[model samples]
Target: VLTRDEAQTRAQLLDVRRYTIDLDLTTGDETFDSRTVIRFTVRADQDVTDTFVELKPAELRSVTLDGQPLDPETLDENRLPLKNLTAGDHELRVDAAMRYSHTGEGMHRFTDPTDGETYVYTQLFMDDVQRVFAAFDQPDLKAVFELSVKAPDGWTVLANGITEHTDGVWKAAPTPLISTYLVAVAAGPWHSVRTEHRGLPFGIHCRRSLAPYLDADADEILDVTRACYDRYHEKFEEPYPFDSYDQAFVPEFNAGAMENPGLVTFRDEFVYRSAVTDTERQTRAMVIAHEMAHMWFGDLVTLKWWDDIWLNESFAEYMGYQTLTEATRFTDTWTDFGVVRKGWGYDADQRPSTHPVAPEAVNDTASALLNFDGISYAKGASALRQLVAWLGEKDFLAGINTHFTRHRFGNATLADFIDSLAAATERDVHAWADAWLRTTGVDTLTPRVTGDNGTYTLTVERTGSRPHRIAVGLYDPDLTDEGRLTLRERLDLDIPQTDGRPIGKRPALLLLNDSDLTYAKVRFDPESFRAVRNGLSGLPEPLTRAVVWNALRDAVRDGELPPHTYLDTARAH
Candidate 1:
């Protein structure tokens, strides 16, 4: 396994020109023969003479560099040592047999039980792309790839770019400069449905066994896809940076989906094998929105290293939930998020294994992989939502557009992102980064109220180092009927005792983070808590009720409130 330091050194030493892999999937019985040709120009700042390429081939047939034959026996477990290479343009070729993977790591092969057919897809996340072809496998060492594959006569082929199928051979269009992990290929007898939306080709695919299910829900899926596409265009300045979009629902997929540029591979269960609830369908819709968001955040403006993996997933998650709410009929999406997604973050943060949403350092690949837990996806998106609320939408969109304009089709660090945000806002983004991103634990917000002669003052006490910008909701009892209360107002203010935010007249109940605008654990004051215990159902707004419920849930997990009391509140409400 290559360490982060070694990858950084290799990235500094070489700039890859292009990668051309010729794979024959028809031969070798169960394994495929891959012949890779790489052209690169090496940088010579010092007297470094040795480097290596990565591959996990079944049998190493030949190794030739710069047209000179190198011994195949010198190939180590997954690396081929290239020796005594000078400083100019160089080409390396390797011919080997690579085994297909059953695990969802490299090239996964699956055989259907009923139809007696086989399918193959690649899930080359982390560093497993080496199992398919030889390359300098790292995010920063990006290069254009042109791949050609020989498959069975009746199978369809998909890749990161459009594929040209002729005479049982599939040649993919040359992709733009992209990371090696983003390269994708899936070949099978696919049942596909194609449509054109706004001058772009869109397609959905499934195996023959699941053809009926896909066709049944094709309209719903395509409508959500088209709606999210239009919504993303409205939010982002950069256009979608691909020729077409094809989403394949593959069997036994590991993740929800891989946002592999033009071709996204999703777990086939999303096609709905059995009857599912509306919530399950909403989840499917959200996953679609999430992966579409990645077309801009992860695929377009990529992170430089694995430590900032949250920058890719967190933004996609936030955009997914919010966009689904705005564009589709899933208007209660955030409520679902507060109930399901945020619970993952809250539980993970309280656990001993919790990490910061954006860790300060990840020393190795192993450490970087561990950081992709709940903190990365759920908590990090929660923080970004808070940032949007605090900074306002106009400024945040401007910052994102600036980031896209500056670092499109390139790699960027966390500092580079902050710099782009700083260029668009008056608030101190660097300070916010230090407080919100650099810290490891979650913040706790408690409201304190004081009343003197019919005037009330409410102050929010912050328990962690991070600062919070939240909305406080004041709700008074209905004067006409005893059913629900009237919302006085939602005051947007900073927490930890700020000025100009006066709690003028007291209401029946007070709510913190009124629409779940922040990412902090909240608790009510003594009087407010008592009011909540009695009149929890009187909260008219569902969002406000969700925030309150989540606060009680957090209180129970943190041991500040008893479990029975929390359940009793729920039962009473």
Candidate 2:
């Protein structure tokens, strides 16, 4: 594993210029030839003697530093030490035979069971970049990447940039400053759907076996893609950072999707081989919107270290659902996020392995990879949603645009992001970050209501320290039908109340965290609980019902409410 300390040392000493990597995939089935030439400059003021580049190869054929041959015998495990390094510019070339992987780590090769067709794609996330090619494999040491691949006659090559095939060699356009993990390659006899959206080439590819399925949904997929692309362009002042956009549905993908600069890779299952619900299609659209958002949040401006992974995922997650809701037909996207995705975050947060949304420190790469769980994506996005609620969308977007402007094509941290947010608003964003991001577990908000004559005062009792700006919904039983309730009015309230809120003439029920704008376990007041038990299904909006259901689920998990009561409520509703 590449420890954070070692990465920092290498980053301090070397400034990578660019990587020119050549892969010969026609060599064989088990292994392929990989040759990488790295040009970097050592800081003149730093007296660094030696540094190492990482590569996990089947056979280390040769290595040369500054055109001087180095013994291949010196290769150690995943690291090849470049001894006697001097300051100023130097070039390092490595020639090796890299093995293909079946476990979806490095270069994963998958053979279709039905037709004996072959497909391969790189899942070079985290330290897996070494499994394909060699370089300073860290997020902070961003560099330009140029790739040339020699594949079989019928294969198509997809990469981080526009790829052109000429004279049997496919060469990709040089990428902007990006982390090594974002370097992607998927080569196969793909079924491709191509189009032009807003003068940029947009393509989607899948394996031959999934051609018909891919074709069936290609128009819908492209529609969502175009919608998201346009929406992101509007939200982010930074124009599309890359030359084109391509989404490849590759086989045996480990994660749902990877945000490679111009090429985003999704698991081929998204092509849909069977029937799916509208909600499922909406989920797919959300994923499309999510990955497109990464084109700016993750690819354009990356995280400095693994600890700040939330900077990439959380931003994308929030932007994905929000953008999908605003720009596409998937207007009820957050309802799915709240009903389906939010539980993942709450569960992970309560686990023994739970970490803060942004941990103070991730000691090594191994520790960092584990942090990609629900907290990083779901909880972090929820925090951002809450931030937007409190800070207001206009100021929040201003901070985001400022963030992109300040660190375009670079890396940033949580503190840096908070600084960006603080610059755009008068609110104490730093305090919010400390309270929401630096903490673990969920906060409980139990409503306390008291009435005098016809007027009622409401107070929220919080169990945790994080501040939340939430909505309280008031509902009244309909005069025509008691079982059907109508929304009275929604009240916005902030945690740690400064003054008592006297809401004149209380309604039949009081629901906290009404719109699901914040991340907290909300509890209904006694009257509201009774109303929910009788008419929970009367909540007009799916998001409102999701909030109520989630509260009951949390109560059951915490043993505050019996499992049978939850089940009974579900049965009745």
Candidate 3:
């Protein structure tokens, strides 16, 4: 495994200019032929240095630096050393027989059981890029990649840029400056549905066996894609960075989806072989929105290292749900996020393995990979959503646009992001980053209420250091309907109250974090708790209901509310 220090050392020493990779997939089923020519320049001030390229090849065929031959036997583990390199432009060429993956890591090969047709795509996140092509495999050493593939007679190849097939080879358009992990390729006899959206070619692909399924829902899939694209453009000042947009539903994909510039790959289950619910369809749309956001957040402006991966994922996750709500028919995506996704974050945060949303340091790649857990995606996004609630969307978006404009097609860190937000608003964003991003575990907010029938005071007691701007829902039983509840008023409150505020004429239930705009675990006042036990299902919005249920769940987990009580409450509601 490559360490962070090693990646940093290599990144500072060399500026990778471009990579020309040729993949021959016609050779056999077990392995494919990979030839990579890397053109780079060592820093002018640096002395003669020895650096290495990474490739996990089955057989090392040949290696050359400049025009000189190097022993293929010198390959150690995944690294091939380029020894005694001076400070100037150099081209290193590596030819190898790379094994195909069944584990869905690198160059994953799958044969559909339905048709006995084969397909292969790359899932090269982080270190897995070495499994496909040899290069300086770090996020900071951005480079233009030109890929050419020789595949089976009828197979179609997809890549980071537009692909064109002529004669016997498929050549992709050169990509913009991007990390090795972002370079993608999928080749198979695919059933494709193609269209033109805003002068750009948009397409979806799947294996021949799933052609009918792809065709059945092609219109809906495309509709979501186009809606998300338009919505993202409306939010971002920067237009779409890549040339074409292609989403390929490949089989045996390890991740829900990967944001690979122009060609995003999803697990083929999203193609839907069987029946699915409307919520499930909404989830597919959310995933589409998520990956598209990455075209701007992760692909366009990338993180400098793995430690700030939340900059990629958290933004995408938040933007995914938010955009899906705004632009698509799925208007209650955040309700789903609150009910399902937020639980993942809360549970992970409570674990012994929990780490900060953006930890102080990730010493190596192995540790960095571990950070991709719930904290990065769910908790990190919750923090961002909270930031938006506090910072206000106008200023939040301004900061985002400024961040993009400052670091477009380049690398940035957590500090850089905070500085951008600081520029957009006068609020203490750096302090917020310290309290939220640099901290682990969820904060617990328990409400305390006092006073009489028509007059009351509400106090929110926080058990953690993070500041929150949350909504307090005041619900009353409907005058006519016995089981229904009416929204009396929704009060906005900042945590760590100066004093118990006079909340005149408190309703039957007082729910905290009613809008699901924050990350903290909230609790109800005694009256609110009693009301929730009786009328939780009567909450007007799904989001409010989700918040109330989550509070009850936390109460049960903390032993404040008995398991049987929760079950009985669930049954009663």
Candidate 4:
């Protein structure tokens, strides 16, 4: 396995120019032929005299560097060594036979039980793309890829770029500079639905057996896609930087969806193979919004190293829920986020394996894979939401536009992102990042209400290091309506104290983090806690109810409240 230090050293020494890969899938056998031609320029460094390309083929074949033959014995494990190279442009080609994977890691090959048909799709996360092609196999050493594949007659081919089929051969349009992990290909006799939206070609695909279900929900799926696409354009100054948008719903996919620039691959289960609830459908829509957000945040401006992966996923997660709420029919998306996704983060943060949202160090690809947890997605997005709240939406959007404009089609680090945000405002964003992102564990916000002579004041207790911009809701029992509470007021307040604000009088119920605008474990004061125990179900807003329920649930887990007490609260409400 390649370590982080090895990949970093290689990237500094080489500048990849381009890659032209030719694949022959004609043989009716397990192994297929692969021929890769990589052109690169090496830098003038003392330790850069030799480097290696990566591949995992079933059988060894010929290797040539600038038409000079090299011994196949030099190939070890998945790396092929290039020796005695000068500081200039050079071409390295390798011809071998690679086998397809049954697991969804590499080039996965599946045989459908219903129709006995075969399907091939690639799930090359991390270093698995080398199982199919020979390249640098690192994100920072990006290159344009031109692909040519010869598949069986009457089969469809999809890749990261636009693909066209001619006589017995398929040629994919040269893709923009993208990392190897983002490259994708799915080939078979797929049932496709094609459309054009806003002058860009759009497509959805699935296996032939699931055609009926895909057809049933085709309109809903495409509607969400179009809506998210348009909304993202409104948010980011950079336009969509791809040829077309293609979504393929493949069978037995390990992930919900992958944001592969122009080609997005989703699991076919989203096509509704069985009865699904409205929540599930909304999840589908939110995923659509999430992957579309990646089109700008992730695919356009990628992270320089795996350590900054939170830069990709966290931004997408926040945008996904936000955009779904803004654009699609899933209006109360944050409620689901509060109930489900936030819970995931809270529980994972309490675990022994807990790490920071953007940890100080992700040692290698192995550690980077471990970083894809609740902290990276939910907690990180929560921090971003708080940032938007603190910085204000206008400044937040301005920073994001600046970020996209500056790093489009290139790579960036966490500091670069903070610098962009700093440019937009005079506030200390670096300090904010330090408190929220550089630390692990969740914050606890305890509500405190003080009563004085004919008046009251409210203060929030912070249990963790991170600062929060939260909203406090005060509700009074409705006089006309029996067993219902009406909102008295909502005050947006900063944790750790702010300018004095008036609280005219106490109310029937007081809720912290009422709007779900921040991420924290909230607690009710004694009076409000007793009020919730009696009348939890009578809360006016569903989101407020969700926040209250989440707090109660967390309390039960902490043994602060009994488990049966939580059940009773559920039963009462």
Candidate 5:
């Protein structure tokens, strides 16, 4: 059912040239009509046979292809069949009506109880692209989409590209090349803040009821966007590929955000009608950066299939944090990743559903959907951070740029990405890929120290199959102050004992897993444990303090330590 050869052959046989989609948005009976025209070129070698299109059965009123009525008996919920299709080049058109889904799948219609204003939007999860329109829903069948909607006079419509309005109808410019799931549209009486940066239009929007809150944070939000955009320009040779960039905070969005080319849709809660912490603002910035990266990685050069989803998410995660740190005011972004994000990786790695950062095989759409979890986003990000440390930032970036250049406006596989990286770096990136990306489970680091004749020796024993390049810190007791530890030396070492020699000098406190740069669980020696209990707050580095706080947080969550005692310890510190 999940054959790579079949998918590759299918991709080679079909090339979608254009799509003209028309939607009527003013129906009050919770149903709407849609008509789609898909023009494509077929490979010369392919013979006349059968073709299939995906769509939902219950919502479909009727289907007609190429102005000829299709047999109702041939219809099903997932796929429609056509016999004796010619191979050279062809056009397939469809007309149907779709009902609103309450479970957040497709064409969701909701009325705000507070203001009595109604809104309509689309939320196409993993394989729900068929619920709204008829098309090839798989990732490999990349296509250009042209959307037009007829809505009420007062409502505004947003889509995957720049939009132009005429006679109460909104029409979006055709998108470059994108997957079916990334297509999006929202129509409502919206509140919008518009501006221009670097000759490109930029805007942020929300529901009319939340206009004041959006206005309050407009400057900060747009500043973050401009900074990240400028930073990405400095890093890559290619400029931004899309036309206009807009971010909309829509209601009841299933995910944090969907990277829908020019129009990125986010959950309306980000408008922030209530009080929020600084950490929440940082999170919002991070998601913005993440979705922008997808405008290049996933939208421009896509993965060939679902199995290489990590290629999209992992690259975006790494770029999101690093770019924001280099270009925006959120310079301490990795601190949050260590304290909150990497902790997610560690917890999920210990669960039964854990998989490698890049799994060897995914049999079908159902299994591929399950892979989009902590191991894919968080653990994959940690692995990439380690890769940068091992390969150096310059070469890592060079490798990424090459990958993008070679695969621009096309689809690539995991092996193709690895080959590009191997070409850029002289290091054993191929070997590193095998040990890190292809492996599962978390590593454990244990510290052992022995002191004799004023000489101290610290030896680290690693207990896992995966290899790690980690930072080890050494601290000494400050003689003037009671229970205070002072920094002594920091050592960068590769685990699995590459040199076959013990690291010399027993530190007064040997801190394993320092800097929180890698994904691993650290166990402290008796002296280091005592130091952590008493002097954690005295550490000069906030990142180090965050690591200790995370360890205590995990201990409490796992019930290894009483929650009240952990709180008491934090209170005492």
Candidate 6:
């Protein structure tokens, strides 16, 4: 990624001491200006004759290093050159202005029609961080950020860390070392509910127009936050790394939510201004938990490059559902994952855009942005969940704790995380990582049944190249029921076996990849397929039913089954 390369270069160029960013928020123009002072300790032995700052063309109104004016011609969209610098501590200050981007980049400005309130939010997705400020807009060039914004008198300003209002200007607490893409700010007339939990400030915010809707489900929203926070504390050695946790339901946010440290920005639709299904509410809760996990996994301990972004997102995605299931009232969260999230992974993995969960050699930001798809989030999470199932929860947690402690306030590659896991267990996690994270494409698990005398055998045949840790379920007809199939036993197995497991009694049905914990399409045995078509709802576990539903969903997407057939199957169930 361009951000990764620029970050690596900047890391070599300067030892960034701190960043002091000042913004005039009330600049009513579509464009705003910024002044940044980047102070760095120079190498005493080397004459820093040529130093560079990363900035775009239209952005730099003027440039100077320590008040000496520099030529605009020296500016490259990716870098600004500075000459005649002595080897000592020095300051590189930039005075720049940039227009807001309408296409989900840079500082995005818009006005809310309902309340007539003007709002400004920044969405610097991938490489857009440079559109807002002059810095090394890369993942590894972590910098301590001090932000000050002058906003309209009645509007509030939020950023990556906690902000204190002073003299009509909002000043953010200097952030711990963080990547620029994670730096954020939102300024507008906002409605907010503020509280504290376990000594940490917790708040939910939305535009003034959505205040009524936000108030309706305020309790549930905050309860989800409290539950996930408590759960993460129980799981990790480090507490929440940032100050004050704020979830803002902003308007027309590009993604579900941008995990911007203390200030997370969500699409206002999460406020539920209109009636929505209980399933929708569950989804909102999951998103909250997902973004919260990022506070630790993505924000606290960062990926060394865009290539290792799975270390940030996939881990958060898995922990989100797992924590919600263990700690919150959402006990059947994995069912939703199967029906919705896994479907996303399955669909994307089958598409032309599919990439490995942990992709190797992502050369620039454009390619990296393309990879923020289903495989990275959903399938990657499922793979991790299966890893937890195989390695056991305690060891997985130990490995994760070690990974976070070792990489806190720093950057880590995917290898670093796997090595930590390898330290926690003698298991071949490196091989697991290679098979699951490095390889592209999904595997197909087909259930083959054989019988000998009174015994039945069920064999799992993996059709794809990737290996899988999976669960096979044997179901038998309930003695008192006509159609219901009860789970007889669950067999945990690694896939691609040539032999089969013998059951003393023939099962009414056999299902492959029963839990949907692996990124694979499952082919049910003939009897199981018939059972799924006729009596899927009779399955005891909602998660099992979800898996069956997902298979049908996948069939529809793959054109193997007619869409109407899927609908008929759903209706029959």
Return the TM-score for each candidate structure.
0.97, 0.99, 0.99, 0.98, 0.94, 0.94
Ordered list by lDDT, greatest first: 3, 2, 1, 4, 6, 5
Off by over 4 Å in 5: 1-9, 57-67, 500-505, 551-571
Q: Report, for every candidate in turn, its global Cα lDDT versus the true structure.
A: 0.88, 0.91, 0.92, 0.87, 0.81, 0.82
Residue 330 of model 4 has an lDDT of 94
| Selected candidate, larger TM-score, 4 vs 6 | 4
Q: Which ten residues in a row have the lowest lDDT in candidate 3?
A: 521-530
Candidate 6 lands at a TM-score of 0.94
Give per-residue CA lDDT, model 2, range 319-391, as digits (tens): 9999999999989889999988899999999999899998998999999888888899999999999999999
lDDT of 5 by residue, 90-148 (tens): 77777777787766678888778879887888877567778788777767687889999
Per-residue lDDT over 1-573 for candidate 4, one digit per residue giving the tens place of the 0 to 100 score: 667788888888899989998988877558888899999998866443888889898886999999999998888888888887788789998898999887788788888899987888888877898988888987888889899988888789998888999987889999888887888888888999999999999999999999999999999999999999999888888999999999999888888889988889898888997889999999999998999899888788988888899879999999999999999899999999988899988988999999988877777788889889888999888889889999998899999999999988888889999999999999999999999888888888887777777588887778988878888898888889777788989998887887445678888788989998888889888888877978788888788999999999889887898899888888888
Tens-digit lDDT string for candidate 1 (1-573)? 678788888888898989998988898457998999999988867364779999998999998998899999988788899887778789999999999988798888888997977888888887888999999988888889999999998899998888898899999999888888898999889999999999998999999999999999999999999999999999999999988899999998988899999999999999997889999999999999999998888888888889899999999999999999999999989989888888888888888898877887787777888887788999999999988987889999999999999988888888999999999999998999888888777788887788777688887778888767888899887888675777899988786655435678887788889999888888888778887887778888787788888888888877899999988888878
Candidate 1 backbone collisions, by pair: none
Instruction: Name the lDDT of candidate 4.
Output: 0.87
- Angstrom error at residue 64, model 5: 4.1
Greater-TM-score candidate between 3 and 5: 3
> Once superposed on the true structure, which residue ranges of model 3 sit more than 4 Å away at CA?
none
Clash-forming residue pairs, model 5: 456-505, 456-506, 457-506
Q: Which candidate is the best by lDDT?
A: 3
User: Which residue runs does candidate 1 get wrong by more than 4 Å?
Assistant: 44-48, 481-483
Q: Which stretch of 10 consecutive residues in model 4 shows the poorest summed lDDT?
A: 42-51
State each candidate's clash count.
Answer: 0, 0, 0, 0, 3, 5
Q: Where does candidate 5 have its weakest 10-residue lDDT segment?
A: 498-507
In Å, residue 478's CA in model 3 sits off its true spot by 0.8
Task: Give, for candidate 1, the lowest lDDT window spanning 10 residues.
Answer: 493-502
| RMSD versus native structure for model 3 | 1.0
